[model samples]
Target: MGPTLATRLADWIDELGLTDHLAAAGLPSFTRDASGAPSWIEADGEPLSDERLAELDASLRDHGDDPAHGVPVALVLLARKARLRAELLATPAWTYDHLAEVRGASLNATRFWVHKQAEEHHLLTVAQGEHLLVPAFQLTPSGDVRPELLPVLEPLLAAGTDPWDAWIWLTQPAGLLGGDVPERLAADPEEAALVAHAATRLAQRVTASPKPRPRPAPSPVPPASGGCGCGGHH
Candidate 1:
């Protein structure tokens, strides 16, 4: 089954290690109802303060039936609950224009939809400028996925391996997540072999050439005080 809103929110918090912050904030942990909709409440079983509850209500109401919108809102809630200002600033979810470009869709409709999604998910704060930035987060560039792996993995996705499997295979070996390479390889034998083979080929290609020699040193000039003029001084 596809990831649920609660699961996605939990994953972001757990991955970023924000549990302590959430506890400190006194926000209730996220939970889902039988219908698969996510909800939260205060730890003391009392409703949140008027202002805070209103903010949360606004976020909940704004989301207007788009699955993609869940990703950003869950992320935002986790950030707010955990007080993870730094991480929030780091991954400002893609803006409306960014979504349009990536999805190759109409600008006006895409922006409206994206805005609705963000509102529903509570993923962003007030929109400003031409783009909306994540309230407290700043996004950094994720390096390109290894070029060789994309070809291999795209086919697997097309053929239909679970997305988590695809995500793990594409990202792990490149040390995107860092840590013991061999351990990761052992965990997934087939993918590990593919990555190793690709890496070996890439290495061989790069090292096959000899390093270029340094350019020849320039000739030195005589000092002005030297007696090398046409007067024939010895």
Candidate 2:
């Protein structure tokens, strides 16, 4: 009922100033139908299908709404993809089999250890499909989880931080760690304890803070034109 796909595509084309670029590339210019919805022509003289406009809209959604200032759209897409790849590499998800292989433990024993770590110890575990995933960064290359992690996790969980949030806090850059993440600091026992202490203080502060009570809703205003909106002024 709003702008048709073709119409939206036409709007984006103009907003992005793609007309001249397309022309320079020897591509056909966008045209409109009698109803003002967009149509297209191929680089050749042949007419393009309306489906092409819809496809164009679908592809553009991946770039997100903001066009980075003075950056090419293709470069924006590349940067976005690079950022995603970096994040994925930084916090890899470890499955039971992977952990078992790395730790030299039997699969059953690994599963049992993971359960105890998650439940009794409050280490972070994410449920992904039928598998439970732990962040690989929490473990050392020799395949043991960092000793300093659990103490921090205990305070975080006690303060009502969920496992996922706890994981994020551990991995996020911190001022106390000179802009290094807690996970990286956790490589050193003393630094890891410092991270835990910071977590404890944070949790304590949150636990000590007073919760705000909900405010009551305002009553409807009475009209001054010889009537109340609620008909109470009659």
Model 2 over residues 1-234: C-alpha lDDT tens digits? 897655666676677656445544444457767876666766654565777655545555555465322334653444444454346445677788888888899999988988887766556776545767777777778667677677877787678664555665677776766778886787687687788888888678768878656544445557888775764000
Cα lDDT for residue 81, model 1?
Answer: 34
Q: What stretches of model 2 exceed 4 Å from their correct place?
A: 1-90, 176-178, 205-234
TM-score of 2: 0.48
Candidate closest to the true structure, highest TM-score: 2
Q: Give the per-residue lDDT digits (tens) of candidate 1, residues 134-185.
A: 3222112321122334334334433434332333333334443244342244
lDDT of 2 at 146: 71
